[model samples]
Target: MVTLAEVAEHAGVSASTVSYVLSGKRSISTRTRERVERSIEQLGYHPNAGARALASSRSNVIALMMPLRTDMYVPVMMEIAIAVATSARAHGYDVLLLTGDEGPAAVRRVAGSGLADAMILMDVELDDERLPLLRDSARPAVLIGLPSDTAGLTCVDLDFVATGALCVEHLAGLGHRDIAVIGEAPAVYERHTGFAERTLEGLRGRARDLGVRLLHRPCDPGYGPTSATLARVFDERPGTTGFVVQNESAVEPLLGLLRQQGRAVPEDVSVIAVCPDQVALQASVRLTSVSIPAEEMGRRAVERIVAKLAGDDADDVTLIAPELTVRASTGNAPG
Candidate 1:
């Protein structure tokens, strides 16, 4: 078998230098490091995982806790998970996927067993059950969503409040007075997930300030529920001329229903979405949207946890500013 000693010999460096290159405990010259890496690759040298862990006191793995619920936007969640895995790999670590169903116990188990060097949690609620355990554990951790109290936690997420307000401002600027919001599932609000509640809060506060009559409806995912929700929205506010939809599953359905009702988009009504850019571009009509930045959030969370593991204190909450893109679905309010 190709060994570390052989790689070191081939690279004309000491075994200790090769070890330092692998562990990153000490810096080696860039040229020397590159040479050692090339030799290791050419010789197909695979280090002993157990030996490396013992030497560094790190498993070189990161645990990612994701929600198991289907009610939320599954595509976005999946994209974040994929991004976390990819980014973690780039940082020389592997990812351990744990579902939210495991709850706080999972956090304790991973921390106690040294199964991972750090953790990144997703789908965080305002008062998440895992927060206390994370705070008490020695393992470094970062959250992909905010909590009610961010006292000592590292968090990375889009500023959902600003995102919501941006959507309203765009429509209101175009002379939209009566606007309706299609929110996530009722269970989402009942749980008081920070993002959902914050978005609603921003939307309502801005709507009031802009003198726009806003109606919000929590919608179940699918054609039937969305149809009923749309009907109720118009029934409650007959003059509604603009829409801010947070529910991704309901976007296409809402557009279809509006067409069926003979409402010409932008000419009769304007629509805006708070979703990933891909969703906006592929919709039946190109949608004006405030992007969720799922991949960026995931990448930032992993980076934060990795930094924390390296003895960097990462206790601050980082909120990515929201950016709205204009497209075919929005226009000046009707005459």
Candidate 2:
């Protein structure tokens, strides 16, 4: 293994000179710097990240805590994760992906151990258990999902409330009076995930204002659960003429089930989704939908954390506005 001492000896300079050249803490003469650089290249001497972090007090790493649960869609989570990783890299930081459901302990461990300079949390519940620790810790954190309270936190997410309301308004405007929301899996709602709850809040609130009858059904991912949920919605509201689906797993199943039941989309019923644009476009039916801005949310979360790390202190929740695209799958209610 090549050491700094070897590079220093080879360059005919002191070890301190090599340290200064690597850290740029102090200016060195151009000739000396060039000679050290040549020696470093020739000897293949690389400064250790741990040593650099200890000296600078910054690891230049971000910890992303994302719990992989079966109930939620993996692709969307992966999209956001990829975005976060790439964005962090662009900002000269590496991502330490912590896929455990470590709750608050993960934060304490990472923050205390100096393994990462900051954190970005995902799959946030409305009243998250990790918030208190994050609030008290001096280490910077940014959430990709919004919590019920944002008083002392930085968060970035899609405006799912507006997302839900937009779906309702789109269907309602098409004269669909009875709208059914195909929500996330039962466990997701059971845990009171912030996005799911807020979306429901907006759906119910807007439904009341628009005089639209709304039925919400929490469905597991796959054909069987979606089929059963659809049956229940139809049984409860026989006049149901619209659907607002938030589950990516259920989109194709719902579309297929509707077809099997002899219902033509936009002719007998209209369906819209709250999902990514890729999901909307690739569905069995090109869905009229509110696109989830995963990339933007991920990028913004990193930006906020980077800003905070640089002592910017601009702690505030950022909600990306929802954009609903009208595609092939929506139209007026059945006459």
TM-score to true structure, per model:
0.91, 0.95
- Expressed as tens digits, the lDDT of each residue in 225-320 for candidate 1 is 999999998888989999999999999999999999999887898999999999999999999999989899999998898888878975899999
Which residue ranges in model 1 land beyond 4 Å of their true spot?
A: 1-21, 24-43
Clash totals for all candidate models: 0, 0
Scored by TM-score, the top model is 2
For model 2, where is the 10-residue window of minimal lDDT? Answer: 67-76
Predicted structure 2, TM vs. truth? 0.95
lDDT of each: 0.92, 0.92
| Candidate 2 ranges beyond 4 A from true positions | none
Over the stretch 1-335, how does candidate 2's per-residue lDDT look in tens digits? Answer: 78889999999999999999987889999999999999999999987788879978999999999976857867778888999999999998999999658888999999999999999999999999999999999899999888999999999989988888888999999999999999999899988899999999999999999999999999999999999999999999999999999999999999999999999987898999998899999988899999888888889999998999999876898999999899989999988
RMSD of every candidate to native, in Å, equals 2.7, 1.6
Candidate 1 TM-score, true structure as reference? 0.91
